[model samples]
Each structure stands twice: as structure tokens, then as C-alpha cells.
Target: MSISFKKLIEPDSDLASVISQWENDPSIIPLTRPNQNQEELDHREEVTVEELMKRMEHHQIYLIYLDDQLVGEMNYMVDPSHLYKKETGTAWIGITIGEPVGRGKGVGYKAIQFLENEIKKQGLNRIELGVFEFNQTAHKLYSKMGYKEIGRIDQFTYWQGKMWTDIRMEKYFGSANNN
Candidate 1:
């Protein structure tokens, strides 16, 4: 299936509802959730159209579509702390395949490829992301996509009745001359 990304501009009610539903989905939450606490889970407020619109002003959020169906969302931002101030060619990304049907397929891999191309157009040379140590599936997928594990934060999050580590991964896009 061909996957494409649509930049989320103005808020749409249907899109907002889908995001809200994904936030509350048990199957989907664990993959992206930072903690296992019920309070943290309940803290996600229903996404409102207005809120989404406001977020659009500050973030690059995109809806992932397979054919004509919405299946997931991804977003990225320039390093907020200016960690790569001298480099100025790095961005952090986050992705979620909210629909179960989209999992185990190549949807996320393709979507990320598309996002990387888009980021390159803006002169970015690298992309970075974090994945929980327990999310082996995502770790494998990212590795297949050429992301290299840069570091790990041991026992950074509490989930599944234990502490879990967060693994950091990064991919670099070499310029034509370097390649």
C-alpha cells in the first residue's frame, strides 16, 4: 500500500476525534505512553479542533494516509534546547500508527521515509527519535530504516510494573558530495 502524508493545517473535527480516540486506545497507548500510571493515561484530554489549530501554529504535524484512509499521525520539531545549534540541521520526530491495521505492515516505514525527504528539503541533515526499550518492534523497524542507537537512559520510565529504559536513535542524511 502506498503511504502518504498530509500536513495538518486547520483542525478538522473528524481528525480531532481520531486523535482523541487513539489517545485513549489501550492497544495503541502502551507503544507511545511514557508511563503505566492510570492517572497519566487519564490525563489526556479529548482533542478539540481549536486546540489542534493552535498546535499547528507551532508544530509540524501530519496525518498519515494509506490510499484514502487516515491511519496515523507524525510530528517533528527543531531541537528546542538548541543542542545542535552549530549543526543547525537536526530535528526530533515522533510517530504513531494509531490504527491496528496499519501495524506490522510497511506503512510506518514508508511514512517515515517520506518525512525524512520532506525534512531534507528544509536543509535538515539528521533526524532523531526516542523509543522505549520494551518497544522491540519499533526498535527493529527503525534499525531497518538505518537509524543507529546513539544512547540509552536506563530505567527512565515506569511501565508494566517495572522501570523501562529509553533508547535514542538517530539517522543522518549525507550530502551528495559525502555520499
Candidate 2:
């Protein structure tokens, strides 16, 4: 099936249901935030939905769908004060696919492709993201997407009764001819 990205502002009932599922899914705890509890999840969901609506105003976040079914979500954050390096700008990214069947089906790579295109359209030179050491799946996917490991924080995250490092990955986007 063809997978595409759609920027979601106010989610419909179907999309809201998918976001709610993602918010409460235990699997996301390790991949997303180490310390997010139920209450925190509720608060985050509200804030995320609101932020996404605002992002739709600026076309910064997108909802992924496969054959019209909600598969995942991605957001690109470009802050000149932080992620921008010289004229080569960069974006901080976040993504999650709540459905199990979506995981190993190449959705991650497709999502990254969509984000990279959008970032390039915005004239950004690079994109970056941080994944917890425990998120091996995402690490592999990011590596597959040509994101190089630039740095790492050893034993920085404490969660799930253990500690894990945070790996910072970057993908440089030069001009079309150079890329």
C-alpha cells in the first residue's frame, strides 16, 4: 500500500483515537520519554494536539497514513538559536507509529524521507534527532536513513529501573546536486 504524510491540525475522531492509543501505549515509554506517567501522558497528549494544530499553521508536523489508516506521526522543529549551524540550518525531530504492523514495514524510512523533503523546501541544510539507547529499532532506522552518530551522552537517561545513553544523530542535506 502507498504511504503518505498528512499534516494534522485538529484530528478527526479516527486520528484522535490513534493519538490516544499512542499516548497510552506502554511500548512508547522507553522510546519516547523515560518518566512519562499516565497523568503526564494525558497532559502531553493535550499539549501535543494543540502544538500540532499550531504546527499545521506553519506546516511543521505531519500525520502518517497507509491506505488511509493512521500509521504514525512526525514533527520537525527548527529553531535558529539551537539547531541552526551557520547558514546550514537543522531541525529537531520526533516520530512515533503506534500500530504494531507499521513498525517493520518501511514506514520509518518513508517518514524520514517526507520530513527531509519538507526541511529542504524550507532551506534547511540538515536534520537531527536524539534517540534513547534503548531504542535500538529507531537507531537502526535512523542509521539506515543516513544519519550519522555525531555524539552521545553516556548513561544519561534513567528509566525502567536502569540507565541508558542518548545518541545524537544528524543527516546533512546539501544542495540537490550535492545531495
In order of appearance, the predictions have TM-scores of: 0.88, 0.79
Q: Which ranges in model 2 have alpha carbons more than 4 Å from their true place?
A: 12-14, 34-51, 54-59, 80-88, 175-179
lDDT of 1 by residue, 12-85 (tens): 89889999899878777767767746566446668889978887775689999887789999987776452322
TM-score of 1: 0.88
Cα error, candidate 1, residue 87 (Å): 5.5
What is the lDDT of every predicted structure here?
A: 0.80, 0.72
Per-prediction CA RMSD (Å)? 2.7, 3.8
Give the Å shift of residue 150 in candidate 2. Answer: 1.2
Backbone clashes in candidate 2 total: 0
Candidate 2 lDDT, 1-179, residue by residue in tens? 88988876565655666676786676775577544344443344533455446556644768888878877888887754433232345678888887877778888889988888888898877787788888888898899888888777676656666667889878876646233
